[model samples]
Target: MWPWEHVAVGYIAYSLLSRTVVARRPGVPELFAVLLGSLGPDLIDKPLAWGLGVLPGGYSLGHSVFFAVPLALAAVGVAALAGRGSTGVAFGLSYLLHLPADVYYFVVFGDPPAYGILFWPLVPAAGGSIRGDLLSEALRYFTTFLADVTTPEAVPFLVGEALLLATAAFLLWRDTAARRRGRPEATTR
Candidate 1:
């Protein structure tokens, strides 16, 4: 999945979870933390793989559950100790969700879900890095997506993306409006 898709799915997950678990909505900082978590793997792995060629592929290191789980646990532990547990939860959830999202997309596209990526060095790395640098690879990916966007197989993905974006926008607008109205219960940092 793309970064925006990861973020969109993460936001949706966080919003739903917070609504169910917390009495109040999450603050802006918490939301940003979630978004950051959603992009965390790509931020780390992409630079190492595409920019420096330090790893075999773009799905090593940070993309692994072995790395992410312990790190997320540490985040939660530290935040709870520091009285910022919510932020840690937000971050942890977003980070963890990215893995499943990648798996989900693979299944949606008719490929077997890539459970191997989660284990990293325990499991062998997948072959084939994208050609060229990060910017070039992203451009190539987007171009390929555009070229394939009109096919029947792409419809579900396109619709899903649209819904995710629309829902996020609606939620953001509602939150902003409530904040602007001086609704203390709806206030977020």
Candidate 2:
């Protein structure tokens, strides 16, 4: 999934979860935390793999359950100590969700679920290696993605992604507007 797609999925999930469970929307800080979490895995692994060739693929270390789980737990623990438990939860949930989202993306594209990406060193990602410097590689991938999405076969997926992104944007706007109105209950810290 693209960065925006990851953010959309994370925001939608976190928004619904906050509304349903806490009866409130996420606050600005929580939203920012979620954004960071949504992109954290890619931020870590991609640089190591594509930029520095330190990892075997773009799905090692940061994408692995072993590292992610521990990192999230540590983040939550540290945040709790500082009285920011909700922010930590937001970050952790979004970060964890990224793994499954990637797998789901593969499945949606008619490829088998790439669950091995979550296991990392235990079960290596199939046939991925260093491509190039991060900037060039990202641009190359984005170009390919643009071309792919323009194809007739990508219409259904594109439509679904559009709806998902629209929903997330609307909800975020609603939350922000409510906060601007000084409605204390509309915000969650």
Question: Which structure among the candidates has the greatest TM-score?
Answer: 2
lDDT of each: 0.79, 0.85
- Per residue, candidate 2 scores C-alpha lDDT tens digits across 3-75 of 9989988888888888888787789878998999999999988888888888887888888999999988988
Could you tell me the TM-score of candidate 2?
0.93
lDDT of 2: 0.85
Off by over 4 Å in 2: 187-189
Overall local distance difference test of candidate 1? 0.79
TM-scores for the candidates: 0.89, 0.93
Q: What is the lDDT of residue 102 in candidate 1?
A: 76
User: How many residue pairs clash in model 1?
Assistant: 0
Residues 60-116 of candidate 1 have per-residue lDDT tens digits of 888899899987888888888989888888899899999888766777667898988
* Shift in Å, residue 98, candidate 2: 0.5
